[model samples]
Target: MPLDAKTLCLGALEAGFDTGYDIRKAFEDGPFQHFQSLSYGSIYPALNALLVEGLATCDVRNGDGRRDKKIYAITDSGRAALKAALMEPLAADQLRSDTMFAMAFVHLMTRDQVKRILDEYARANRRLGEELGRLLRDRMCEHPGHQFLLRLGEDGSEMWARCIEALRDDLVAALDDTREAPEAAPTGGAAAMTARDAPETREPGSGSRPGPDPHHPRDPR
Candidate 1:
């Protein structure tokens, strides 16, 4: 199931994040970060909605001496709602990658750019995999689902890094071969076809833009 901000906040409360900031951290940099994301713009509104729906409650309390803090807690109804949402059929996983998107248009980029991107992508995945592995080794997450996710993330990340490493040389070689290939002179008919396809200088025109990547994760605050 594609969970929404309200359910995400409810999950955080279930996990013991009793403050708005704490709930944000749960998705921002805490255990849920690897799989889900929510921003304040969505969080606050969802929290308010839950409150109005009698699914949550808020209490004012002392804070850092200058301002009061509002603590949030999920009601029994909220837990039931969360449980119901979780029981729904889940959508298949989606992979959205800026690096992969860039690679799709590799012919338009310089060889150096492609090399740098591949190197950085591999290093990033390796680092994330190592971090997830450490968490798994430490047994940091007690929940069976959480433990399973940590392992899944670690394995996926490591495999991606290895794949990138294995393919880098071949991709670079292909780029080199393309660059070295001679440009053949076009025949008169071929020249006319090329001219027809090309946009003329100073011509004002428009075409459809690329649609959004449906697989992308939610934007961060």
Candidate 2:
């Protein structure tokens, strides 16, 4: 089953992200990044729910000459809930990427467009790896498990970037050999496509072929 935004918020609170904004960042680009994602829209509601359920506490404090800020912290109940959730059967990992989904429809794109997409994807992956590396260098993750996870994500991202860069030219070359196929080509293989692409139907009774006539007998000789 998919993890809910509320549960993720609890994890972020326990991880020392005391503010709603910080919680969102944790999933966007901090420790929770790469493994999980959360949107601000979901984060705020979850935080509210946590407070209501006594799973978390919040403190309002003075801000930089502006509205006060609310700092969130997980309660004992929240920690226990997080622990229980983790111990349950975990969901299988999935690769959720917009770039990857776009790549699957490459036939709809031009060669130049395809090149740009590949280049951008590689660059983004490289950036992610570097960011993770910086976190490790700054000693943000102290525990061995935390370090291990960051290192793993960093290495995996860097390796994938390299793989994409290496295979780009070959993928482009292969794509060049194949013509674009119709987006809505029916199933059942090429024959089905052929039937779909056949000449459009005209009037129900209108004869398309010329009728044989005595005046044009003997093959019109």
Candidate 3:
């Protein structure tokens, strides 16, 4: 006797609420708590489908607010459906991410591959940091709500970027001293060469055969 989580979340938006945090709290310790709570996985898709159904529209503010956040709002049809959906039963939810599951096996990979992953991950984190910094500096200041959201995201990104950089630097330092080519060990033939015979030379037009070329400067007559 519960409404679908997606519909319920959209209804909340129609009731002058939007943003992921607002919807999450609306479900937290509420009637919708009986159903699975929303996450980035659920929220983004639900919002997109809502827009496709003409039930919502986003208000993207460009340039900056103080911390730049693009806000979303709901539409008229969204309100009527929200009321109707409240009476309907909630559908079951599925939580699956293959990428995350694959990452659990990262330690099983070769060291070189792991190092590459770390470097790529650090660069990606740094890019996210730069983008978030730009957003905070350009906008998000006008409203306390938006400013808080921007700061929240920025702080999280900054922390991750720093962690990634530290790990990558450590890996690079470890690799530097470990990559020298091993000196060719003295084979039995090389040992015999030093003991019994002078170093053999390849004659002109010879096909990789070792020969005694006395005419060579190193081979005395």
Candidate 4:
């Protein structure tokens, strides 16, 4: 099931992010990096909805000639809501990636373009892996479950980076082979090979035990 922005924001608050910017940053730099993303477009409206529902409160902190900052905090009602949500049956996971889609049609792209794409992909995964590793090394969490989740995220990021690097090497070698055999016609076997070598469309988070589904009302577990 798709998670709503509002519940994710509430979870961010419960996790100690006090501002909308901080909540969004948490998604980019924290555990959510592995599985989900929420933009400012989603965040601000979610924050507003939470306020309207009386589940959270916000205080405006004036800045120096820039935009004022709003600090948010969960209320008692918000805590209850979060607990209820967490206790509910977890939703089915959904994975969506434009990178994977582009890679599926990689045969149509030039070697240079493929190189650029692989370089960018490797760079991004490497950065995420490094950040996750640093977070695990420097920060300590009291909750065993949270710690487990953090470790899982770190492992996933590192593995993804390594896999992407391996793919980059393979692609480079394949391109070189193709250049050396320019007269050879592309074969059906090549299509089969590409299909076999393509990355899994589903992301890493799907197989994990279910968590709360924020979009729907609680159902009996």
Candidate 5:
């Protein structure tokens, strides 16, 4: 199932996280690191909503005169909700990658730009693989499921890094071939200009623009 932010927060509490920050950290560093991501923008609001709905309780802990911290714990109702959510049929997996989308237009980019992109992508995956390796070696590999997830993340990162490196080599070879080829006459025309100026397609329900409002008057002047 596609777990909402609130359900994820509840699960974090069930997993022993006490605050919204802790919940975010759980996603960043724990077994969920590979498959899930949560930001404070979503985490704090979800925690507040959970408290309002009586699914969770918050404790105001006094700090050392700097700031107070709010710790959250799941209520019985929250536990029931979490369990029900887990038992629900899983939703289809969603894969969203802005990198992949940009790759579709790689031919429009210079070789240097393509190389830079591939370098950054490989570096990021390498860093993630290292972090997962450390976690698996240290505390996170005790549980069977945690161990499996950590290994999955570590292996996936390594595989992606290798794939990106291969892509870099292929791109470089293609660029070399393009440079060696004889130049053709420029094909500049209205059709080419229109194609270049056309806007990229946006996904459905992307909400990049507001829907029409019946109450608003259109300005004709």
Candidate 6:
């Protein structure tokens, strides 16, 4: 089943994240790890629902006297609600994301499609890097647990952004090479099909067909 806004809001508060971004990060961090995850796409709407229900309240902190930033904390009722939710049986986890599943087909995709995917991911990562950097430099350091969390957030975001940027570079290089060199025979398909059909024969001599030699590509005979 799906998680309702109220329970999510309460759980976030119980986890000690005072703002929507903080709560979002809590889901991404290793503490929750495989158990829970959410992004701004889920956070904002749920937070708004919580506010309307009077379960949480926001306070403003002015930045450089330019614009005020709003941070939220749980109310007494919110704490009570969170405790009640925690006492309940765990619900089955459900995740739905077509964008991620599409990534499994990167090798099978057209060159243009692969390039587009990498470039899109790079842009998204760069945006996240900027957001996390701003939060660390301007806001998170002053808070308690936030300092450590901000450090983790910075490292994680930077590494992830770098990885995506590297992939984009690799794809661009492949495109450049393809423009220069003539096409070669399609590789890996026939071998992959064979593997799929007779995976148990992978050890060699376990079946009638001979397996590929690990030491050399050419046959000894």
After superposing candidate 6 on the true structure, give the runs of residues whose Cα lies further than 4 Å from its correct spot: 93-221
Candidate 6 clashing pairs, residues 3+ apart or interchain: none
Question: Model-by-model lDDT, in order?
Answer: 0.76, 0.78, 0.55, 0.73, 0.76, 0.62
Q: Distance from true position, residue 80, model 3, in Å?
A: 15
State TM-scores per candidate.
0.75, 0.73, 0.36, 0.66, 0.73, 0.44
**Which candidate has the top score in TM-score?**
1
Most lDDT-accurate candidate: 2
The better-scoring model by lDDT among 2 and 4 is 2
Model 6 Cα lDDT, one tens digit per residue, 102-216: 7665444556777777677767756666666676676436655555665665667667666766555554554334333322424466534332333232333333323433222
- In every candidate, how many clashes are there? 1, 0, 11, 1, 1, 0
Residues 1-110 of candidate 2: C-alpha lDDT, one tens digit per residue: 86788899998888789999998888888876989989989999999999999999999999989988999989999999988989998889988788888877665666
Error of 4 at 206 (Å): 39
lDDT of 5 by residue, 199-221 (tens): 34222452323344422232334
lDDT of 1 at 179: 44
For the record, the alpha-carbon RMSD of candidate 5 to the native fold, in angstroms, is 14.9
TM-score of candidate 1 to 2 decimals: 0.75
Positional deviation of 211 in candidate 5, in angstroms?
A: 51
- The TM-score measured for candidate 5 stands at 0.73
| Regions of model 3 farther than 4 Å from truth | 1-107, 168-221
- lDDT by residue (81-158, candidate 3, tens digit) is 886675566556564644336445443444466567766766765665566556667743565654565565566666
Ten-residue region with minimum lDDT total, candidate 2:
212-221
